[model samples]
Structures are given as structure tokens and as C-alpha cells.
Target: MNKYNDYAKKMNCLYAELPEYLTWHKDSKEWEPRKKQEVIGRIFNCHPSDGEKFYLKLLLMHIRKPTSFKDLRTIKGKYFDTFREAAQYLGLMETDSTAEMCIEEAATYLMPAALRQLFATILVYCSPKNPKQLWLKFENFLSQDFEHKKTLNQYAIKHKVLDIIAYHLDSMGKKLQDFFFVDDDIVTRTHDNLFKEIQTERDIIIPTEDLLAIKQLNEEQKVAYDQILHHVNNNIPNAFFIDGPGGTGKTFLYRALLATIYSAGHIALATATSGVAASLLPGGRTSHSRFKIPIGENNSKPCSISKQSALAQLIKSTKLIIWDEATMAKRDIIEKFDEMLRDIMSSNIIFGGKIIVFGGDFRQTLHVILKGTKDDIIDSSIVMSPLWQHLHKLKLKQNMRASLDPHFSSYLLKIGDGIEYTNDKDEIQIPPQANVPFIDDNTTLNTLIDMVFPNINDENLDFSLFVNRAILTTRNDFVHEINDVLINRFPGEETTYFSCDENTYTCTIPDQEELFHSLTPQGLPPHKLTLKLNAPIILLRNINPNEGLCNGTRLLCKGFTPNIIYAEISVGVHAKKTVFTPRITLEAPHDNFSSIPFKRKQFPIRLCYAMTINKAQDQTLDFLGVYLKKLVFSHGQLYVALSRARSIEQLKVLIRPSTPLIQSTDYTKNVVYQEILKATDTH
Candidate 1:
């Protein structure tokens, strides 16, 4: 116990298992190969967005002291013309075996059902080279539990496991007949083309505290809960909006309602505008995923739901529909949802005569309008809809945090309502106590990082510190810089992984590889990713919404198994839940960076020591460092940034260095569209 209690991983007399990545190096006395200097591994980005330069950058990052381009592409005696050719010859381009590695790593932590679902997702989205081989390799782990049920009949168990996999594949719009490993019965079953509804039944995994808290809902929550339940119990069609600010217990009320309704055996369809919020609810899902809302800028299309589809059946059976963060959605999207529901349910009444509950803080950022004016943005909000007038508006003014931090709560309200005193530039002064002592811009960033994560290397530091504290800025580039500074300071050896990119479209002439690597598409991971153990990272894409892995979701890295990175969900109800992430293919936005489309295959995660201000919504933190190096550029950005912390003590602001000409470091611009607040006012 004494020998194993300290840093010693292996007991002197006992045989303890270690991961394959770790091994005893006789020369280096460390679990991992020793580095010349213990510095964070750096990534190499090409000077220009060119294909050859990008490949050269990859080689430069891995190999030290490359004299020139020719040196990087030259092996022992073979001089390769293409950098990618040299990389492949060096055994860096191929990761065909990652499929098996992903399953093996996930098998150690994920539940059998979750692991199977992950495998299915990998097969569907990841495009592993050999899907059948992955199944064969992890067949025992995938159906480990069910295998015991029919141990005497191994063939039948394998068939049953394949059937379950077939069901999962079916839900994702794929068929089992394509996989040659399936049994004849499974192949015959694919003719039905069954549209299986994901999460057919609510699992009722609500927290005990939330369940018990139902009896303790403040008067505001009780009123909203009872009014909605009245219509649900009577099967009466009604539209209602639950308007509340950040800590007003909107999620608390939703969970309570879901538990009560699910317990009564009625289907309550729970969804949210964002995946993070949706994952907090029992059986919650993104409205876009659940309703199949098309993503585009042109004339919106109705959700792709046929009347006879399983999704239509789910809509028909649904007794109540709860949509969280509804205000973040555009009015057109919501109207489209209502129209889809009406047609599917065969009713003209609002939402196809189903009970609909909408909840969000209108004070938070509205639906983003790309290159839009203030009027354009406000008009896009749900409040601007004519249907908004008909729905009964319910209010919840009792902010749960107000009881604990009165001043901060009131400050948030003042900022949210645009009542704070403004200067000539229409900016509000940040509280002095909340400001990080500023020196220079660079010094401020370092101080901001230190302030947010004090004593980060301490062994006794609370794990929640990583979850609760973050440096938030308005822009992604600023986020990248802050995260880079923090990850390097974090105590652990780092590993760097490079992406395998390909042109998005088939070109007659040729595709530029350099351009593909250079395009840092919004919401996609870069060509080079550097990660360290226990470092926090944010998911840039939604893997499985039900599992709480979604775009803007935060996780702490637990293992880095080459292809699969093991991480635990760090926020929301799914906090502490273990999940495995794989390098999924991500495509550039249509006409975003360039007309020539390209795809980047890499792990869908970025260091989250700092994240953009928009992603900071719905998160309550004990410590928050606001990097105003880039002042927030959107409505409600300033308010949302300041309001994340519970109190002024936990809040710190690091403004971009004050210019000698105009000393406005104490004040920063706050963009709040107060007109939107009128529609969301107390009913």
C-alpha cells in the first residue's frame, strides 16, 4: 500500500495493469518516453494556406531541426517529392486500426449500451475503413452483458447482438443488410425499413434532489408547473412561454415537470435550442435533431418528417413538448416547428393541438443574425412572431441565486435590463473589485488565467475547479490564445495529433492540400491538436446529444489512445459521465472560408481553458475570468459574460490594455437590445 500509495503506479510485488500507451523505459524512468525538456508540445501551422506547406508543417512539428523543405521530405535514403508521400512512408498517414482502438478504449468505461451506440455512430459518421472488423474485434465487449443471458447458445447471442446493432443502425437511417457480418434473419428484417424512434421511453433518470425539489418549487415555479400540467392532464392543446432569467430555475421546473409527467406514463418530448441545455433534461434532445430542422440561410424548409414515419408517431404520442432555450431560436425556425407539428398531428391549433412549453432568458443573446443589423436581429426573435401574442406568458422572477448573492443578482438584472448607467460610448463600467489588476495586454492575459485557475498544479485542487472556472472572450481567436497559454501551464506531458484532410469536392484539375489545412473553419478543430492529461476540452460537434456530448460541451481528458480520446463530461446533468471521442470527419461551411470545399478528419475537441462568450450561456460558475481583449461584439454579450459568476468575488475582468490617448480600461461597451426585453416582460 505504501509503495503504491504515492506516484508509483505499479506495486513492487503485485502485477497491476497499465494502458498500452504506457511502458517501462529502462533509460527514462518515466511511464512515458522522457522529453529533452518538459515543455508543452507545440503545433506547426504553415505560413500560407497551401497544400505542400501544410504537409511540411506537420513534418516540422514531429521532426526537429529540419533545415529545409527537401530535408523534411527526405527519409534515410529515399527523397520523396510529396510531403504526404513522405509522411505515409513514415507510417503517419494511416490510422485504419483506430476503429478497434476506439471500441477497446470505450469498452473500459462506457456502459454496454452506450459502447454499442458509440460503435454505431463511429460506423455511420466516422467512416472507419472496416466496420465488420471492428464488430468482430469487440463483439464480446459490445454484447458482454447479453452474452451471459444466453451463454449456452453463443450463436443466438451473437445474432441477438447483431439485431441490436441493426436497430441502432436503423435509427441513423442505415440498414444492416450492407454489413456482410449480419445473419440471414437480420438481413431479412431490413425490408421493413423501420423508422425507429430514438429514446422511445423516458428513462426517468432525474436527480433525487430535483425530484424532491418539485415539492419545494418557489411560488413562481409552482404556478408555471401547474398551469402546464392542467392542459397536459386534460389533453387540452395550449401554447405557453416560460420567461425567466439565468438562475430563475427554468431547468429545475422543466425537470420536475418531466419527472411528474414521465412517472404518469405520458410522453413528454423534451428539447432545447442548444445541445448543452437539452442534455440537462431527462430524455432531452436538440430541437433540430429531434424535429429534423434543416440548416440554411435561404427559405427555410419544414422539418423532414413524413406523416407515417416513427418520428411522426412519437409526435402523435407526445402529451407535452418542453423546449428549453427557445428564445435563442429564430422566429422562422419556431414557426416552422409549429407548422410541422400541426401537419403531423392533423390539427390547425397551435403546435398540432399539443401542449407546448417554451422556456429561455430573452435577456441572453438572441438568435444570431449573420451580418445583420440590430433591427434584423430583433425581428428574428420569437417575440416578434404574431403567434407570440396568443400564447399565455408565464413569469418566474425568483432567481434561486439571489438568496445567496443578492448584489451580484441585482447587478446581473440591471445589466440584463440595460438599466445600468452608460457613458458617452454607451458602455458600462465594470466593478472595480471584479477587475483583474491590469499591467499590459500580455500580462493581463497571464493574470486572468492565474486568477481563474489559482493553484492549478496543486494535487489537492478540487476537480470542480476545472469544471466551474473558465476564461471567456467574444472571439474564437482570442479563445485559442488563452487556451494555449493555460494548457502549457497545466502539469502533464502533452501529445500532438495531426488531422488527415481531403478536398470536400471532386475537382478536375486538383485539390490544394495546403488550403485544406489552413482553413480554420468555425466550430471545427484545427489541423494540429495538442492535448495533455486532465486538461479541459470542448466538443466542437454533437456526437450523441442524449449522452451530453455536443457542440459547446466541456470535458476533461482522461486518456489519449492515439485515435480515441477518453473524456468525461464536465458540465450539466451528465457531469462526470465517461465518454470516448474519435476523430470524426468535419467539412468546411459552404462558401464560408472558400468556394472549394474540403474536409478535416480530427478529434472534435478543442482546449476549453477559454471559450467564446456565446458558449458561456447556461453555465453557472464559481470563478469567471472575462477577457475583454476583444470586446464582446453582440447583443447581451457583455451581460452574459459578467453574469456567469455567482458573485463579484469569483468574477474578474481583464480588459485590453488602455491606450495612452483614451483611458477607458474601466469601461467596456455593452450591447443590449432593450426592445426585446419588452416582449419578455412579466405577464
Candidate 2:
């Protein structure tokens, strides 16, 4: 270790202690070739937004002197012209055409290919204290190489030679007893020559293979997608919102659109609200991360793209941008991106001349704050805020999961009511249905464990738990309570408690936490995380808090503040000679009864078992049971529950109404009836 440390210290002295131009500034001091970068702070003083003059000046310094005007003209006309043409051919044009055209013949002849060496020399001389000695050393060094003439092409081809030469020179051990050092002014003059040669190539060409793949589209998809494509082909800016529920081939359609545009020789970009959502679309990244927009600090400033940055060019050239999970994106974030696009395109207008297709459900909005006046849905929560209403909205009402149960899907969504279910062929097991057990008894608990345990035994269970109410208390003391129960009884049960009352709100146990950490520790990843859970215990919102109802709901568990609790229920069982009861009511204990506000509805208490109605919310439970208690349908609750299930056969209802569960509500019936009518009218 000592020997290794000695060697490292020696190397650091050799390279780090070199009296090169890089040592001029502190940031340049750490330039270790491969790992460190020479700090080239954005030269804000230059005009034309491109460093053409800066690059040209650096190039001129390398040649030092010219023998004749014709020689200078040959160097300028042949070399400079060739390089400039190449840059132009590659679409490296920046915002400054006049500045780029300032390349004169005399200057070109005087500069030659000395940009790299000049950079190195200037970097070394930037250090005020060591400037003079470095200058004398550089002068002596240059005298030896003055007779040699290096062309731009040769310098480019032998870039490593300069690096190696500098490395070797810096490696030489000092043997002098005393030597007179040069002055800082001389050091500055000598430093000017350091960047004479182009040490490293600046830009590289990336193959468009990965980008091309995103543009492949099927004929069917292209037919449905051509409207936007045609607009882009005509160089018109357009925005589109493709809203559909969880499934309906939104992602597939996006891919087809991308492929069609790219195949037509157009560039395409993709973004999303969060990283997890972004992953749903091809070439995914969160909007903020993709655009590199600084949040909070400078909300007004948009991310800009310089032509010098290759990635900026790539984004600028892209003809289409597909943003998935659009609902989760805030108007400010979109606005910031729009600002960046306009800046890059050099236009005062919006959207950077690119066609953007947004895909997301407005109902699934993750943004807690409202952004603009457009596309604003005036829910009480966002009534006071400015709303950026989205234009060009397209509704995808067709439910692919409807194949699981078309009528029940419609009914569940309409009334916020859930249906009863028996078993899931997907898991080869039965899951608990609805918040209230079919019979409102302890027998439901037994039935649930019996049906669910066998399927759980067949495979390694890994899934997310979604519960509405606590079986025990109203306060969030359930983290340890729930953890202890599962650990003590089930032993190896993996669980995550989504406690709204708790400060952290939600934390997954082991697997889900690991997955979340891997994907999105900052917040929601760019893509939605979909994983299977086993023995997933959920606390349902069955009891009233005033009546000691624990505030538990799927939204709460999934991380939402419960704004209101509509009703309360109380049910329980006392087993003989046991500290713990075999069954507990999903209802809140009637202790804090005075806190709840007045309401017209009557609440019933039950075991708070997973009810069949929650199937509409897209969860698959694995315990079969029936609700024997008389069920009163809330305006929207029942519909949300029933629609969560994959299929209707999974539910088993004992006391369900003779007609559909939601036969009464005007809104429920309207949506269900309207969609059917639309289908009929289309047919």
C-alpha cells in the first residue's frame, strides 16, 4: 500500500504539478486527461451564440508565422474551407451565420491547426504566480519545434502525439541546482501557444439505428395516425392529447406513430411525466430530466439547446415528440419545455416546430398543484389555481379489460359499486371481495384464508397491498401493529403499509421498496410500476372516524390525503380464551364519534374484507366471499370498486340487487348507456 501510494503521489506530482497552460486556473488544475475535464465555463461574452471566432483564434495561434501570402491563402482556402464545409454539411450551423463567415484568409493562414496546444498553454499560464517561469519554459520548448510545420490534418491525425509529448515532458525529473524563471507576462504570451493544436476531436456522429426503430409503424396504426404526421410534414406545430384508461393500446399506437414519422425521414423524441411513466413509451425519460430544466430556482427560464451541443442538434432535428403519462405532467413543466423548444428553434412561438402527442388520463393526475388556465377541471382542490387547459383532446372510452366483463365494467364505473367474485384463473385462487364481506361475518375471513393460501402456496408471492381501513385503530399506530401481526402469524409475509396519518405516508416492505428504489426514489418513476402481490392485505375504509373508524382507503394506501369520509360501520367478534380475536370489524371503534361532520347516509360495519367491487380499480384479489349485509350504493364508490377486477367471474355476490349493482344513479347510467349507444350508433 505504501509503495502504491508513493507511485500515485509521484504520478500526481508528474501530471498534476506540470507547468502547462492548464494550471492557469483551479478548475484546469485537476485536468487528469481521461477523468478530469478542463473547466471551459460557457464564454458568455461572445456573440452570435457560437464560438466560431474563439475556435478560429485558437487555430491561428498554432501556426505562429506564415512565409508568404499565397501560402497563407492556400492554408485558408483549402483547409479552412474544407473544415467549414464539413461542419455545415453535418448541420452544425449555430444561430450566428455572420460570425461563422468571419473566417478571413490571412487569419486562417496565421492560425493553422494550433487550437489544442494554445488551450493547454493558456490553461497553464492562467495561474498568476507561476506564469513567468512557465512562459520561459514554453519559449525554450517552442524554439526546438519552430522548424517543424504541422498541418491541420496531420495535427488531427497525431493528436495523441502531443498528449504523449506533454506527458513525457512533465514526467522528466528536475536536475538543475538553480535556474532563472521567466516573468508572468512572458508566461501569458507562451500560454497563448498551448492551444495551438486540436488535442481532441470535439464532435462525434451517432448512428440513428435506435432512433429509427421507434419509427416503424404498422399499416393500421399509420392510418389512424396520419393526421398528426401530415401536419408535421407540412412544418406545422401541433399538440395532441390521447386520453384512455390504463389499457387500450395507447403505447402501441405511439410506437406506430413514431415509426411512421421516422421512416418518412423525420426525427422523433419521447418524454413522459415521470421516469416510470416515460418507460411505458419507447426511449423514455421524465420531461424534467430529458430537458434538463432547472426546477423551482428559475421557473421562468426554459432549457435551451446550442447547436454546438450534439444532443441539442439531435433534439432539434427530431420531427416528433411522444409524451406518455401526460396527465401526470404539470402545465409549468410543459411550459418550461415549450420555452426551451422555442429558444432552440430560434422562434418566438411554442412547441419548437415539433409535433407532440400526449398520452395520459386526466383522472390519474399526480400533480397536486394546478399550472394553467387551459384544460383546467375545476375540482374544489384546484379551483383557485390557474389551469392550463389542454387542447385537441381525444377520448378513448373503449375498455380492453371489458373483455374480462363488459357489462360489470360499465356498471362498476357508473355507480362506484363493486361486484362479487369467485376465483381468478390468472392465479388459480380466490381473492377477497369489497370492503364489506358478503355475509358481514367472521365466516368470510375463514373463507378468504382458505381460498387465498393455497394459490399463494403455489408460487412465491410478491405483490403490492391496497387497503382502505384498519381492522384495529383509527390512529396510524398500525405500522407496527400490522407488521407484528403479519410477522407473528404469517412469518415471511412481505408487506408495505400506506398510512396516510404517518409522516412518510407510504413505505413498501423489502421487494417493492427495492423496486421503487431501483426505479424512482425521487418520486414516481417515469413508468408505472406493475407487480404481482401475494397475500396482499389491504385495510378498507369501512368505519367512520367519528365512530372510531380508522382512515384507510385504497387512495390513502396508494398515497392520497383522505378529504372526506362518508359513512361509518362497526362489527367485531370475540373469540374465547384468546388475546386476539379471530375476527375484527372493519368499522372504526366509536370513540371519537364527535369529530365526524353531519352526513345523510347510513354506514354499516363489517369485516372490511376485500370486496368484489374493487375489481374495477384494476386490482386482482384472491379470496372468494359474499356480502350478506344489505349494501347501500354511494354515488361513485361502487363503480370504482367493480371496475378494478380483471373479469366478472372472479366475484360472487350473495345480496346483490336483482338488476345491475348501479341501476339508479343518473351519471352511472348515462356513461354506461352512452357508451353502448355510441357503439350501436357506430355499428
Candidate 3:
């Protein structure tokens, strides 16, 4: 009888029919069971050797050394395909790389060396001549060591080989999960040998039963998920631009594909543009980390990993890769990442030349460096790159945002033109009594506290009450002048501010060191502070900066209260030298503005909802206040503001008879009208 069979049978009898298997053997160290011996005898009769010769043959089969990437790939193939044909071919092939890979793969899958040694020592006691006698010796050894906790009982036959392994070794640990083959504890050669023992080509052999048991999804998600799954299974290598409007179930599809590949015994990797987004998914890391992609490395330099490195191993073992917020990836970033993978894998490829998926909306661009269009992928570093292609694309059109401002919110994107507001949809509760009194001139505007906050208990109003004035003016002022007003309003309150422009604003603070210390441990920068401000003022910086900041010698600002105080004046420079200058230039186009308050400071300007045409673009407001003079509104300017509102009631065109709302000889005007017509048709 083979040693493993004897062991397996003895364990089976112990668990199922111990009493029936009991027997007395005086010469033995402990008592034995007759049934246990009989089962061991049956196992011997069923098969011959202890599988030692097969294992040894498998170990000695390969000859090639594994250092190059090609060698690693070859070994990876044989490691995964454990069957007669594959094993025989690998055994006959004399490749050092193949042998090394086999050793590595086996070690990864099998138990540690310490446990193997204990199993081998116990094997010495088992003999075919006195099966019952041997059984007695084993039982006694186990009983005596029960106090020492060195004995084990569990055993199972592996499905592919039907070969026995110590499934439950008491000496190894209470559970398999508790054991790990970490780097420090390993003896390099012994580790290599142990790996060789377990090395065999073993493809994933999922039974029909397990697959049948998986939970499924609703019809729509199922179809979409299946399409992606099929593409992955085929290993279709290409960029996939999946555009779904915000709140569509696009993320759900990504999760489904990941789960499938994982269930099939393959690893999956996930990444995204932001750490916050990465945190939302299981096993997600930043794309920069995954690709070893350095920030601002926009050119030919590429990151590469050795074929035998742990990172490369992890990637090779993974079957699927998912990238979210893909729209933020610039052309250069994607190309550099692809270049690195190709070098590591030794193949010109797309999707790292494996199963890869991407999810994002192109309209939300965050990549500032890449200039190439979506279709162009040129690799100057390589004579040839993978042919430009896309694998599969899915578009999601559903809108899921704050429901209270559905129509208004929807119009912010061109796609939202079709959205209709429904009472049944989600709603944002704005208290009906929250509306506040309005004013025109500086004094009345200064009394505009209720607009920011409705009641005494409303904390939003506290800032307005604490500040000195809310001056209303149509003339643009230089930033320094604005800072002056802010410093005058709040003499000593510390403040926070930022700009969402291409280049972030920098400020030099007098208390830079103190501010740095105060913000540390919280990870905020020294000059950046946090403050709360009213929505309109916030919107001015965030959305309507194109309207204009006051013209003057622009200088850094600080020390503010109620979130709008500006301080720290510097000699504003023009052409890098001329400073403290007052000359202003309106070089850029301006957003429509409400007319200067008529009748001086007599009454609050009538419901001014002024916005720049750029900020106004794609917006459909409940009401719009467009102020115009003699120059005709460009087709570009007119359409940008008009589209913001859903209908005419939402639009209030405040134009004089001579304002020239329409004019001839403007080709761009025709184009704007056609686009509006198209938008209307879609709805």
C-alpha cells in the first residue's frame, strides 16, 4: 500500500467509525483499530508507490535558467497547465527557466517546508508488513504528543493527482490561513526544492456545480456584465472608453467582471485617479503606484520591473485589471504606463496586453499634460507599438445627482437637456421661507445678512453679521484693491481660500511657520486654510472667475474673516518688472453683467441673477438676468447664456431696444442656432 493511501484511510476510519476500528496490539506503543488497518490495506491494494517517483520525475524535468522575461513567461505557462500532456512536455524540455518557474509556482501553492519535514518523519513509521502494528505506533505517537501539541489528524487527496497531502498538520498551525511562507524564514535552496515538489502544470478545473451556484443580476446589468466578461475571457487587449453620465450603474459592471475573474482563480488589480475613488473599491490602488508611474514624467522615460520581482509576479498572476476615472489619464500617462508594461512583459501590447477594463467620462478632463487625441498612440521609444484599437465601449445615460435641482442641475451638461423634473425623483429641501431681502447700493448690500442666512439660529448668517460691508460694484478692481477691502472689513481673523484655475494661487504668510505647525498632522499645507462662505461668493471664484477679478496691482492675500478677507499686498508686476501699477486691461471676453444699480443706492437691485456666459453655458436656470448694451451679443455669447435656463420663464433678457440682440453676417451665429435646434430635438 502506498504511504499516502494508508494515511488517508487511517484518518477516514478514525473520523467515521473509530469504535468499530478498535484493536489491541500489546507490542505497539498505543492501541490500534482493526477497521483502520483494513482501510489502509485497501488503499495499498488500490495503488502502488507513495508517488515519490512521480514527484522526483516532475522535479528533474526542466533545464533552462530563469532570468529573462521570456523564460518567466514560458515557466508561467507550464505552472498553470497541470495535466498529463503539459507535464510530459515540460519534463522532456530541458530549460533552466522552465525548471525555476515550476519550483516557484509549486512553492506558492503548497504547504511550507517545516510541515513537510514533519510529515516525512512520520512516513518512516508506516510499513506494509504490519499495517495494524504501524497504525498502533502512529496512534500512540499522536496521543503522547497531544500534551506537546505536535500531532496531526486531518488528510485529503488532491483532486488532480488523487495524491495525499497533509491537509491538517497540527504542527503547522491550527488553520492553513495562519501559515505563510515569508521571505526571512526561508532557506534559499530548500525553498527552491520545496517549490519543485509542488510544481506541476495545473489549469483551473472548476466543476460545473460551483459555477451553477453563483448569484446573478437583473437583466440589464447581466447583459452588460456578460459583454465585458466575454471580452476579458478572450484577452482582448485595447483601450476601452466607457462613458456613462454620473450616477449611472457603470461601477457596478466593473465589480461584476472582477468578481468573475477572481472566482475563476485569477488575481485582479484595480486603480483610479484619486485616492478617495481608490478607497471606494476593494484591492484598489492609485494608478501611479500600480504602473510605477511618476507624476510629471510626460516623455519617453518608462518604468520597468524585473521579471522575477514581486510586483511583476503579482501582475502576471492577475487575470483582470480595472482602471476607474480613466478620463483623467492623459495621453502621455497612458503611453508611459503601456511602455513600462511592454518592457516588463516583453511584448508590444495594449491593456498591458491582457484583460483590462476602463471606466470614465471624457467630458470631465483632469489630465493637463497629454495633447494626443484618443485614437493616437505613438511610442518613440519602440520601433513598433501595438496597433491602435478599442476593444469594447459602453455608454450610460442615467443622471443621478441632487434631485431638488434636477432641471437646473441637468442643464449643466449638454446631455441634461432631455431630463424632465419629476416630483417623485429625489428632492433637496430648501426651506420655503429661506428667501431673504435684496438691496442695490453699498449700504443696502451691507445689510444683506439674511440672504446668506435666514434666521438667528442659522450659522450661515453669522459671517455676514461679523463682516463690515458687502459693497456692490460693476467696475472690476485689481486683486490688491480687493485685498484692501477684505483687510479693512476684518482686521485680524485668519482665513482660508483657493482658486480652481489652471495654476493654483500662492500666498506668503507672515505666520507661515506657525500656520504650518497648526495644520500639520492634519496634512494641510501652511498657506491653505479652511473657511465657510456663502454660495454666491463661493460661486464667483469657482464658476465666474472669467467675469473678472478687480484690475490693479495683483498681490497675494491673507488674514480674513467670514471667508472673504484678503491681505498682504505686493508690488504687482507686469512683464516681470513694472509693479504697483494701476493700468487695467480687459484683454479677455467678459460674461454678461447686471447693469450698474440705477437710482444710485435707493433700492436693492431687482433680483439680479447675473452670470458669465461661460459659467452660464449648458445651464438652464429658473431665471436669468442678462444685461446688455449696444454691441450685438455674439452667437457664442448669446447661446452660452440662453441654454442655462430650461425655458423663457427661467430667462429674463434685460436688454434695451438698441442692444442689437440679432444681427447679419455672423456664420458662427448660424452654428449656435443649429446646435440649439439639435439639443431641442434630442429632448
The CA lDDT of each predicted structure is: 0.77, 0.35, 0.34
Please provide, for model 1 over 577-644, each residue's C-alpha lDDT reduced to its tens digit, 9 standing for 90 to 100: 88777778888777556778877888888998888889878787778989887677777888888888
lDDT of 3 at 104: 29
The residue-by-residue lDDT of candidate 3 on 161-245, one tens digit each, is 0111122221111212222321222323223332221121012233333244234444545566666677667765555545654
The positional error of residue 271 in candidate 3, measured at the CA in angstroms, is 0.6
**What's model 2's lDDT at 401?**
59
What's the distance in Å from true for residue 338, model 2?
Answer: 1.7
What tens digits encode model 2's per-residue C-alpha lDDT throughout 1-683? 11234333344322212332122346755433223444432221222224565323222222223333233234323534433332332222221221112212112223222322322322322212343344333332332233254434543333333443242222121101111243344333433433221111111112254345345434433444676767777878777667555445566677666556545555666666544344334444456555666654465676644544544666666677887865445556676677777777777655666677877643332343324332242222111213234335555666655676676556444332122332231111122343323332345433434343323333343322213212221112222222333333332423221110101213432212212222211111111111122222222221111111222222211110111111111211110101100011122222233222111111111112233232223233333333323342222223333333445555443332234543321121101112221321232
Q: Clashes in each model (backbone N, CA, C under 3 Å)? A: 5, 121, 26
lDDT at position 162, candidate 2: 42
Candidate 3 lowest-lDDT run of ten:
598-607
What is the descending lDDT order?
1, 2, 3
Between prediction 1 and prediction 3, the one with superior TM-score is: 1
TM-score rank order: 1, 2, 3
Best by lDDT: 1
TM-score of each: 0.84, 0.38, 0.35
Deviating ranges (above 4 Å) for candidate 1 = 1-58, 66-101, 104-114, 148-152, 163-184, 187-199, 297-299, 459-464, 505-511, 592-596, 681-683
Question: How large is the C-alpha RMSD of every model relative to the true structure?
Answer: 9.7, 28.3, 33.8
